[model samples]
Structures are given as C-alpha cells and as structure tokens.
Target: MANSTLLSRTRAERAAAERTTGEPVGQGRRIGSHLVLVLLAIYFVVPLWWLAVASTKTNAGLFGGAPLWFGSDFALGDNIATLFSYQGGIYWIWFRNSFVYAIAGGVGATVLSVLAGYGLAKYRFRGRGAFFALLLGSVMVPMTALVIPTFVLLSGMGLLNTMWAVILPSLLSPVGVYLVRVYAQDAVPEEVLDAGRVDGAGEIRLFFQVVLPLLRPAIVTVLLLTTVATWNNFFLPLAVLRDPNLLPVTVGVYNWQALSNAGAGGEQVWNLIVTGSFISVVPLVAAFLSLQKYWQGGLSLGSVR
Candidate 1:
C-alpha cells in the first residue's frame, strides 16, 4: 500500500513537472510574438523616420545626406515657414479644410451610426433583417468603386467642387454602423431598456441619456475611423473637387509630390512636401494616443465599454 501511495505521488510530481515545463513554451511564444510586433513596428516607422529626417534638411542636404541620417543643418523652422508660405499659404487652407471635413464628418457619422446601430440591435421591426443584410453588403463594396458614382450623383445635384461634396460623402460610414450595431447588441441589454420604460422614460430619452453613455467606446471607435478615413481620403476628393482651394492635405501633398517629381511647377518642393507630411501625421498620432484607453473597456457593460 505504501509503494502504491509512493507511485501515485510520483505520478502527481511528474504531472506537475510537465505543467511547469509547458509554461515556458507559452512564454516563448509570447516572446516570439512580441519580437515580430517590434519588427513590424520598426518597418512601418522607417518611412516616418525618413520623412522626419528629410523635413529638416536643405533641398541640397536632402539629396546629399544618407537617406536615414539627419542633415548637417536642422532647418525645421525654415522648412515649416516655407511650407506655410508656399503659393500664398495654400497649405494652411488645406489644413483647415481637412480639420473641418474630418471633425464634422467624424461626428456626423458617429451620431448616425450609433443611432442606427442601437435601433437595429434593440428594436424588432419590419425589414430589419433585410436592412442589415443591405448594410453588410455595402461594407463589402469598396469605397473606391463608388467614387465615380458618388461624383456623378453630386454633379447631378450641382454640388460639385464644394465642401459639401466632401463632408456629405464622409458622413455615410456603413462600417461604423455595422460596428456600432454589433457592439450595441452585445453591450446594451434589453433588460435595461425595459427597466427604463418601467420608470416612464421615453425611448429617445433612454437612448440619449442611458444608451449613448453605454455606447461611448463604440462611438469613439467609429468617430476615429471615420475621421481618419476623411482625412486620408484621396480619390473621391480628386474626382469631385476642381478647386485647389478646396483641397485637403492628402491631395495637396500629392500635388506637391507630382510637382517635385515632374519639376513642372517651378523648382522642386520636396522639403515642403516632406515637412507637410510630417506635420499632418502628428494629429492622427495624438488622436490615437488620446483615445487608446477607452478601447480596453469591456463592451459587455454597455457604457464606453
């Protein structure tokens, strides 16, 4: 009996040892994943690094220096002055236009998405499934493919070459709606809505005062995505806008890049282009850093969760 007891103890000890041995394999996988992430981070960051380095150089220094290295002289102040001063300070106009479009569009899309998503998730109604199917179908369709049709529609309405043309299109974020719907279905409980009704609260009041607070994370996520999309959107703007004054930084930068490459529009403007590129990304980075903490909250709670 003592031998049998010892044998059982030995098996238990072997099992414990095997468990301990397996833990390092998991740790090693984590380490490998971290290493891969670091590599990818570096890979993506290199161009930004080049943009930063190049922005501080003289037009001469840009061509002369090692591509990754800083120039002999730091000319960030001069470069920025040149960037803003170029062509009667058109860059500022583009910057303002981008801010207007991105903020307005982001907010508009978020509001629409949250409302539609919540209604779809919580309410039973006719054509709900079909509408959802249509929404999902829209997501699968590429935005680029619709650019031409959008331009044609805008042209028909006589909205071409206008700020409305950009802001209006940006507000139609199908993916945002889909994200909010999925999130709301999980986050906002029907029980809560029923409870609100028990207190004689109207649906609009419940949605605004209770449901919206719960949907903050999803709302912010959609807003950030829509903002970024509007900021970076190139093709639609290019197709719709003929006025250079209406250009966003994305298109304006492309304009500079084209001139730089073709040497068609006077002396090449590489330094200004690079400098402008560096400045434009700062807002996006700031936004990501600012909004990052909310993403960690659980969506199950229905509040910013």
Candidate 2:
C-alpha cells in the first residue's frame, strides 16, 4: 500500500511538471510566430511606404531630400495631371495593354494547364510519363534564356511588336501545368473518374462538370500566378515590342523614368514617373489580395490531399 501511494504521487508530480513545461513551449511557439509575422509585415510595408512618400515630391525633392519622409512640397495633383498628359495619355494605353495581356493570357494559360494537367493525371496512355518528364524539364529551364530564341521565332512569324508576340509565349506556363497536375491528381480521385466513366458522361463533360469544380482552388491559384507573371513580364515585352503604343506598364514606366532623367528636355517629370509606378501597382496589389485566400486554400488542399 505504501509503495502504491508513492507511485501515484510520483506520477501526479510528473504530469504536473509536464503540463508546466508544455505551456511554456506552446507560449514560446506563439511568440516566435508573432515575431516572424511582424518582421514579414515590415518587410512588405516598408517599400510601399517609401513609394507613397516619394510620389508626393518633385524631381528636386526626389534627388535632394530624404527617401522615406515626405518633401516640403506635395506635387501629387500636378504629378497625376502630368502623368495623364504625357505622350497624349499613352500611359493609359499601356495600362490597358497590361490588363489585356494579363487577363487574356492568364485565362488561356489556366485553361490549357487545367486540360493538360487533368488529361495527364486522370488518364493512362502512351508517352504519358515521357510527356510529364518533358514538362518537368521545361519547368527547370529559365524563362530569361528563352527570350532571344522567342524573339527570333516571333520575328520569323512577323509577330514582333504585336500583342500576339507576348500573348502566345505567355500562354505556355510549365509551372501552372505542374501545379494543376499535382492538384488534379490528388483532389480528383481515381474512384471519381471510374464513377464518371461508369456514368453516361463523356470525358470532356465529366471534366468540365465534375473534376473542374473540385479543382476550383487550383484554378484560382494558376490564374493568379499567370496574371501576376504576365503583368510583370518586362524582358519579353521589351525584346519583342519596339512600338511605344504596344508597350505594357513596365516598359512604359521605364521609358517615362528614362525620359525624366534626361534633364535637357525641359524639367524632368519625376513626380509623374513615381506616381505612375505607384498607380501601376494598384491593380496588381488588388489582384493579389483578392486571390490570396484562394491561393492559400489551394496550397493547403494540394498538400493535404
């Protein structure tokens, strides 16, 4: 009886100690997480903060004053008016061009990726593994390396300086294909495909109606990724398009900033350049924030399933 009582007391003491230790570990984890998140928040917000402050200043203030703080004179109104007036308001044209390329290319890439990935994942056919291997290899290749070759090809087709030059190449995204493939493979089960086959539904109908619905998260992820990538595609557009009218936001902003640096051409329009860059980012930011929830859910679903 004495031994039994001592054993119970020892067990109780051990349990109490474990509880005390676990509580600190949990608290420490939470604290660490919060600290990391705070750091990340600062990392993202700081540049935007600087951009906001810089956009308010004149060329003299931009060159002469502090980077992170506001200048003595706020030229936001004049900056916007000048930005809109530059080159007969061609900045608006660039903005529209970017939107068109991003949205249209994103949609095309997503559709192709979904179909290609779904076909690869759901079907067993000849050259399937080989095709997947080729796709994986393609994903490993850098897009920068393809620019010269893409330019040559587009030149051969006489498509350079046209929207098609950028749009056609942007449509092919190995990363999107890979993501969709992984998502479709897991989110869409073999049993489900078998059931669809057993039903009177055709493959296209089954994919469009059933499998596609299940892969909504992945679709959104691919769309967002493609849109952002296409929106930010500077090198491709730069290499292919010599026409200012065909220039996207990045190229257009670069030209404006370059011209602004040429002090001989009256006074440099620094405020417009800064404000234009700031405004150019608004759509991208909106798109990112809007799709972030879907993006997170996509990654979670892909990982879990």
Candidate 3:
C-alpha cells in the first residue's frame, strides 16, 4: 500500500512538472522556427533599409558615411528636386512610360491568362494537352535566352525602340497562364457551371457572371506579377530602346548608374540614382499592400472549400 501510494505521487508530480514547463521538443522547434523567420525578415528588410538611408545622403556622403545608416546631411528633398529637374525632367517621362507599360501589359496578360487558363481547365478540346505541355516547357525556359530572339523579331516588325516592344512581350506570361489554370480548376466547380447553364446562361454570360467572380484571387495575383515583371524588365528595354524618352525607370536608372561608373569625365549622379531607385519601389510596394487582402481572401476561400 505504501509502495502504490509512492508510485501515484511520483506520476502526479511528473504531470505537474510537464504542465508547468510544457513539452520541451515542441517548444524548442517553435523557437527555432521563429528564429529562422526573424533572420529571413532581417535579410530582406536590410537592403530596403539601406536604400532608404542612402537615398537621404548626398553624393559625397554616400562614399564617406556608414552605408546602412543616415548621414548628417539629409538631401532627400534636394535629391528629389534634382531628380525632377535634371535633363529637362526626363525622370518623369521614364516614370510615365513605366506606368503605361506595366498597366497595359499587366491587364492584357491577366485577360489572356484568365481566358486561356479557364478554357484549359474547363473545356475538353483537341490538342489541349499539347498546348499545356508547350506552356509548361516555355515556363522552364529562361527569359534571358528569349530576349535576343525577341529583339530580332521586334526589329523585323519595326517595333524596336517603341513601347510596344516591351509591352507586347510582357503580355505572354506562361507562368500566369499556368497559375490561373490550376486555380480555376479547383476554384470553379463544374456543378456551378452546369447550374448556370441550366439557367440558360451562354458561355460568355457564364464567364462574366459566374466564373469571373470566383477567380478574383488568381486575377489579382497575375496582375501584380505581370505588372512587377514589366516594370523591372531591364534587358528587353535595353536591347530594344535607344531613345531616352522611351525608356522605363529601370533602364533610366541603369543609364545613370553607367554614367556614375565612368571615370573622371562622366558626371557623378549617385545621389539621383539611389533616390530614384527608392522612389521607383514605392508604386510596387503600394500595389502589393493594397491587393494583399484580395489574395488572402482567396486563399481562405480555397481552404474553406
């Protein structure tokens, strides 16, 4: 009886200790995961932080001071003024061109992706498997390899050095098409389509009224992806465009960087380059922040379904 009592007391004490301390293995794993996430966050954020600090400094301060921290002389406003006034305000032109290309290309790509993806997911057509395979293969091919061929094709068509040169190529997004196809397959049920058909809805009517609303998340994702891709495209624009006015902010910044790199005779416009780069990132950041909720909702909806 005394031995039994002692065993019960020992078991109770162990349970109490566990309740107080929690499971060590699971707790350690959680801590390790949090540490990894914190490290990754710092890795991504440090560059942006450095860029912001650098943008606030003058050309001399950029070389003299700590790269990650702000300098004594805050020249962000002067830098902005110079950026706008430099070479007859060419930066604004580049900014405008970027907006045009991103919007037009993004919308066009999203539309095509939605249409193509929806068709591939829902319809039973001849050569569908072959078309999808080609798309997957295209996705695997490096975009840089195609830049030369695209340049030649654009040159032959007399589209080189024009906005269409960039925008046209940006519209052909194989990844976006694949993303939309996968999303549509699971998101839009055949039962729903049949129900719409039972209501005498035509294909176009069903697409607009029934199918589109369900694919909102995929559309937003594709739009953001294509827009960012076109905005950041440097090699394509550099290869095709020679005119300063036709260049996007990305290429415009590169031109400034090249001039800054040239020894002695070339102008040192490092301040403008850093400041311009910082400014250029704002629109994309805004776009992601604004559209985040839509995609998040889509994820939740998919999970629930």
Candidate 4:
C-alpha cells in the first residue's frame, strides 16, 4: 500500500511538470519563427530601401555619406520633372513602348503556349515525340548564343531594327510551351477532354470554353514570366533597334546612365535617372502582386482536385 501511494504521487508530480513546461516550449518555437521571418523581410527590403533613398539624392549625396541614409536635400520632385522632360519626353515614349511589348508579347506567348501545350498533352499523332523533342532541344539552347543568328535571319527578312524584329523573337518561347505542357499534363485530364468531345464540342470551343479556364493558374504564370522577360530584354533590343524612339525602358535607362557618366546631360540628370528607375519598377511590382493572387487561386483549385 505504501509503495502504491508513492508511485501515484510520482505520476502526479511528472504530469504537473509537463504542464508547466509546455507553454514555454511553444512560445520558444513561435519566437524562432518570428526571428526567421524578420531576417527574411530585411533581406528582401534592403535593396528597395536603398533605391528609394538614392532616388531622392543628388549625385554628390549619392556618392557621399552613409549608403543607407537619406540625402540632406530632397530632389525627388525635381528628378521627376527632369525625367519627364528629358530628351523631348523620350522617357515617356519608352515607358509606353515597354507596356506595348510586355502586354502584347505576354498575351501572344500565353495563348500559343496554352494551345501548343494542351495539344501536345492531349493529342497523339505521327512524329509527336519528335515535335516535343524539338521543343525541348530549343529550350536547351542558350538564347544569348542565338542572338547573332536571329539578327542575321531578321536581316534577311528585311525586319531588322524594327519592332517586328523584337516582337517576332519574343513570340517564339519554347520555355513557355514546355512549362505549359508539363502543367497541363498534370492539371488537365484526358477524361475531361473526352467528355467534351462526346458533348459535340469542337476543338476550338473545347479549348477556350473548357481547358483554358481550367489552366488559369499556369496561364498567369506564363504571362507574368513572359511579360517580365520582354520588359527587361536589353540585348535583343540593343542588337535590333537603333531608333531612340523605338527603345524600351531598359535601353532608355542605359542611354540615360551613359549620358550621366559622360557629363553630357548635366549633373542633375543623374538623380533623374535614379528616380526614373525607381518609378519604372513600380509597375512591374504591381503586376506581380496582381497576378500572384490568381496564381494562388489556381494552385488551390488544383489542390482540391
């Protein structure tokens, strides 16, 4: 009886100790997670923070003082006015051109990718494997290495130095096709397609009304990637376009940077260039945030399946 009583007391003591320690253990884990997130936030925000600070400063302020600190004088308003008026308002032209290229190229690439990918995934025909192999091979080739060949081809077609030269190349994205094919194969089922066919739906109708809606998330992904690529594409634009008016924001920014370095555009223009870059980035950031929700929604829809 004494031994039984002692054992019961020990069990109760152990339970009490566990109850007291559990809350601290959970609190410690939460603190660790918060610390990790804080560090990650700092890592991502640091460059943007620096850019914002630098945009408001003169070149002297930029080159002098603490790198992270704001300048003594706020020249942001002046920078905006100068950027807008630079080169007879060429910067605004470049901004519009960027929008045209990004949106047009992105939409074209997404449509082509969806059609090509869905066809490749759902249909089987003679030489299908070979066709897919060609696509995979195209993706493997370095785009930079093909610039010269592309230029020559465009030259032969009398399309070099025109917007067509840039837009045409942007339209043919093997990587986008490949990504769509992979995603569609998993996300879109053959059974659903067969059901559409049984309902007397034609291929075009089925694609737009049925499969395309189902592949919204992948479509958004392709669109965003293609947009960013086209917007930031510098080498191709540099190689193909010599007209200052035809230049996109990336090349236009380079021109500004060059002028600033040569002291050709005056000292104040340096701050203008920095401020322009800061403004230019805003739209891209907005695009990502807007599309990100759609991406998440698509992922959830797929997960539910």
Candidate 5:
C-alpha cells in the first residue's frame, strides 16, 4: 500500500513538472511575446541612445539633424571638457554633494526600515496591526503632496536650505519599511530564534548574528531603492537647498538647462548639459549591472532555501 501511494504521488509530481516545463508553446504565441519584449526594449533603449548621440552632437546637429541619427561631428570630448570647466568646476561639488546625500540618507533609511520592519514582523506588541496599517496608508501618500508640510516643518527646525533638510526627508521611506516587513516575516523563523535563545544568545545577538544574515537580500533591495530614489530626487533638493554648491547633480543639470533655454546664444554650450546628463546616468547603470545578480538571488532565495 505504501509503495502504491508513493508511486501515485511521484506520478502526480512528474505530471505537474511536465505541465510547467515540458509543455510546448504555440509558435505564434511565442513570437508575439518576443515581439512585445523587443518593442519594450527598444522603447527604453531609444532614449538612452538619443541622449548618447545628442551629447556627442553640436547644438546645430541637435536642432538640424535627424532626431535618432548619430551626429557626424563627434563633440563628446569637447562637451565633457566644457561641462567640467563651466562655473568654476562647481559640477564636481554638486557631484560630491549628491553622493553624500544619497549614500548617507539611503543607509540611514535602510537601517531604520530594517529594524522597524523586523520588530513589527517578529514581535506582537500593542497597536501592532494599527501601526502597520498606518504605515501602509502612508505609502499611498505621494511625496510631492507632503513637500509643503515637510518644508514648513524643516523650516521650523531651522533645517531649510541645508543638506540635512534633504537627507532627513528622504529617510522616511514607507515603501522600504513595507517591503522589509514582508521580507522579514518570511525570511525569519520563530524556531530559529528559539534555538538561539536555547543556546544562551541574547535577542540583539540573535538578531544581529543569525537573522540579519538571512535578511541580507531584503536589505540590499531597500538600500538600492532608497539610494536610487535619493540620487534622482529633484523636488526635495530644489525646495530645500539654496546654495549652488550644495545642489545635487539633478538640480545642477537643471540649472544648466534653464540657462541654455533662457535665450538665443544661450544654447551655445548646450552639449555640456547633454554630456553632464549622460555622465549622471553612468553611475546608476553601473550600480544596476553590479547588483543585478543579488536581485536574482534575492527573488529566488525563499523558494530555493
């Protein structure tokens, strides 16, 4: 009887696997899916390709040439030179300021989200459900909507027009907290904590030594997201900072754009703006390429583990 039951279960498993992996898809359906993917890929890639070509083109080439066509006069090197040399090399300052804000704010936010999420997930405290609901509700609130109130509060605290104004506001990422809470609930097990307790481990030690390792993928996800968000942030910085030196790349690039569009001959060094924009994109692309493997591992972790 046992052998017969085992054989039936094995057959069922085999059938399920075959249905998922061995079934033949229709040729038309496969082609349609591929075509859709190709179209989407082109949609995203075209903008970056245009940016690259535009950066290498003279201002005349930008206005006169085919929008998607490569410019014959390669001015990429000249554009970069002008970009760095403009405004007493203040671009370097903006670049540094951006890194400082993004990294510090991202790390701070990631840590806070991780701790709050882990506590909420693992502990059954008073107002736990209500607090989490509030958090989720906050996620529905747009950042732009809160900008005015945030500015007011920051001004009251004398943080306006300062780097802290930007960094402090960015640290409250409801989405990161929500994502980490979900991850922590699934990645951490009560049995493991119990085992650590039995082995004479303190709660903090267990969290730091045992649970934190398992929660790495979620941590990375939150870190990457917060960092990118902070990096690309425009409105917050624009609202918070007044000094040109404290401006991030986004605002600095925007300043160049505003000047170029101000009047005729205003577009003389427009290629610098294009080149600077392209340069701003490089760090993000490099980050994505470097961390993509971790994302795959993160997504597969629960299933494989």
Candidate 6:
C-alpha cells in the first residue's frame, strides 16, 4: 500500500510538470516558425527601408553616408522637385503612362478572367477540358519565354513602341483566370444560378445581380495582381518601347540608371531615380491597403462557411 501511494504521487508530479511546461516539441516548433517569419519580414522590409532613406538623401549623401540609414541632410522634398522639373518633367509622363497601362490592363484582365472563369466553372461547354488544359500548360510556361514571341508578333502587327503593345500583352493573365476559376467554383453556387434562372432572369442579369457579388474577393485579387504585374513590367516594355515618351516608370527608371552608369558624359540622376521609385511604389501600396478589407472579409467568410 505504501509503494502504490508513492507511484501515484510520482505520476501526479509528472502530470503537474507537463502541465506547467507544455509540449516541448510543439513549443520549439512555434518558436522556430516565429523566428523564421521575423527574419523574412526583415529581409523584405530592409530594401524598402533603404529606398525610403535613400530617397531622402542628396547624391553625395546617398553615396557617402550610411547605406541603410538617413543622411544628415533631408532632400526628399528637393529630390521630388528635381524629379518633376528635370528634363521637362518627363517623370510625370512616365508616371501617367504607368497609370494608364495598369488601369486598362488590370480592369480588362479582371473582366476577362471573371467571365472565362465563371463560364468554365458553371457552364458545360464544348472543348472546356481542352481549353483548361491549355490554360494550365500556359501557366507553367515562364512569361519571359513568351516575351520574344510577343515582341515578334507585335512587330509584325506594327504595334511595337505603342501603349497597346504593353497593355495588350498584360491582359491575358492565365494565372488570374485560373485563380478566378478555382474561387468561383466554390464561392458561386450552381444552385444560386439555377434559382435565378428559374425566376426568368436573363444570363446577363443573373451574372450582374447574383454571381458578380459573390466573386468580389477573386475580382479584387485579379485586379491587384494584373495591375501590379503591368506596373512592374520591365522586360516587355524595355524590348517593345523605344520612345522615351512611351516608357513606363519601370523602364524609365532603368533608363536613368543606365545613363548613370555611362562613364563620364551621362548625367547622374540617382536622387531623382530613387525618389521616382519611391513615388511609383506609393500607388500600389495604397491600392493593396485600400482593397485588403474585401479579400480579407471574403477569406473570413469562406473559413466560417
């Protein structure tokens, strides 16, 4: 009886210890995951922080001062002034061009993706499987590989050096279509459409009233993706556009960098470049922040359902 009582006391002590300490393996894993996430966050944030700091510095401060920290002199306002005034304010033109391309391409791609994805998800159509297969295969193909072919095709069509060249290519987003397709399949129900149809609603009416609202999250996601893609597109714009007037900010910034690299004759516009880059990122950040709620809400709704 004394031995049995001792064994029970030992077991109780062990349980108390376990309760106090929790699971060591799970706790370690959580710590490790948090550490990794913190590192990643720093890695991504450092460059942006550097860019912001660099934008606030003069040419001399940018090079001579600390690379990641702020300079003694604040030149952000001056840099922005020079960015606008330099070379007849061409940066404004580039900025405007980027806006045009991003909006046109993003909206167009989102519309097409929504329509195609919704159709693929809801409708029974001929060659649907084959088309979807082609889409999946296209998604696997790297975008860079298509640049040359796109360039050639645009050249043949005499569309090179035009905004259309950039905007047109940005419109066909295979990933956007695929994302929308996957989202719509579950988010938009067949029964909902059928219920609307039974009420004598036209297809267009049904799409507008019943289906489109359900796919808001997917639409916003595609819009942001396509817009950002078009905004940040460097290679295609570089290859297709030769005119300085037509260049988007991405290519235009590179042009400034190339000039800076030129041995002695070319002007050094590093301050302007840094400032312009900072300005260019603002719109995209604002867009994401503004639209974040819709997608987050959708995700929460899905999770709850």
Top candidate (lDDT): 3
Cα lDDT for residue 114, model 3? 94
> How many clashes does the backbone of model 1 have?
2
- State how far residue 181 of model 4 sits from its true place (Å): 1.2
- The residue ranges of model 3 lying beyond 4 angstroms of the native Cα positions read 1-36, 264-266, 295-305
Ten residues in a row with the worst lDDT in model 4? Answer: 1-10
lDDT (C-alpha, whole model) for all candidates: 0.83, 0.83, 0.86, 0.79, 0.83, 0.85
Cα lDDT tens digits, model 4, 1-305, are: 22323333544565687568644564445777789999999999999988888988886788888879787888888777777776788888898988888888888887898889888888898888999999988887888897899999999999987888888888878877876776677667789989999999998899888898877767887777788889989899889888999988889888878877887645446676778799889998886677676655433323322
TM per candidate comes to 0.85, 0.84, 0.84, 0.82, 0.85, 0.84
lDDT of 1 by residue, 109-200 (tens): 88899889988988999999999999989988888998999999999999999999999998999988877887777568789999999999
Q: What is the lDDT of residue 100 in candidate 6?
A: 96
Q: Give the per-residue lDDT digits (tens) of candidate 5, residues 201-229.
A: 99899989998998888898788878989
The TM-score, computed over Cα atoms with residue i paired to residue i, of candidate 2 is 0.84
Global Cα RMSD, each model: 9.9, 9.9, 11.1, 11.9, 6.5, 11.0
* CA shift of 65, model 4, Å: 5.0
Which is better, 1 or 2, measured by TM-score? 1
Q: Which parts of model 6 have CA positions greater than 4 angstroms off? A: 1-39, 295-305
Per-structure clash totals for the candidates: 2, 0, 0, 0, 0, 0
Q: 9-36, model 6: which lDDT tens digit per residue?
A: 5435755875665445544457777899
Q: Encode model 3's per-residue lDDT on 91-110: one tens digit a residue.
A: 98999999999999999999
Clashes of 4: 0
Query: What C-alpha lDDT does candidate 2 achieve relative to the native structure?
Result: 0.83
Write down the TM-score for model 3: 0.84
